[model samples]
Target: MIRGVRGAITVENNIEAEILSATESLFKEMIKANKIKAVDVASVFLSVTDDINAAFPAKVIRMQEDWTYVPVMCMKEIAVPQALEKCIRIMMHWNTELRQDEIQHTYLEKAIQLRPDLTKQ
Candidate 1:
């Protein structure tokens, strides 16, 4: 079966180092929470708010030792009115046996407000 693990984090600034660091942290947390393996990841899609243009989140994944072959894409999030800012969101498509409800999603920093229901208090 295939599953989608979602995660998001807010960057402190629109700088390359901050973006990459935040993305790496979010990706690590998501994979750790769900016990995901690099081989099982089909693809990853990252979306960042318009204010974030300093770097591409996919670069973080590509830098991982075992994630070289894993496909990754990055795009700009829709400019929704009143939406979150300086946010980086990721959707990882994984091949796993776990049921949809059993998958763990990660939300960190100010991005936690985006999905209060999924995030632990």
Candidate 2:
């Protein structure tokens, strides 16, 4: 059976390093929680809030992972009133045998507040 894992992280700053770090952490957490190998990921889609336009999160992931095979895309999220800023969200379509409840979703920093029920202890 295949499962999808969703994760998100917020960068406190718009700098390239900050964006990369937050994204890297989010990916690590997602992979760890879902027990997914890079090859198990069918595709990964990332969306950044309108405030983040300096760099593509997918490009950063490819560079950091040095994986030429996994597909990744980045897009801009709709800017709503009082929406969270500097946020990067990821939805990973994974080909795995894991059950639905076994799939772990990660929400970090400000993004955690967006889904307290999922992120809170």
Q: Residue 113 of model 2: what lDDT?
A: 82
In TM-score terms, which candidate is top?
1
Off by over 4 Å in 1: none
Error of 2 at 36 (Å): 0.9
Error of 2 at 62 (Å): 0.9
Q: What is the Å distance of residue 22 in model 2 from its true position? A: 0.8
| TM-score, cand. 1 vs. native | 0.98
| Tens-place lDDT digits, model 1, residues 23-65 | 9999999988988899999999999999999998899999998
What is the per-residue lDDT of model 2 for residues 1-121, given as tens digits with 9 covering 90 to 100? Answer: 5677889999978888788888988998887776678877788899999889777788766875545688889888888989988999999999987777767789998898887877746
Clash totals in order: 0, 0
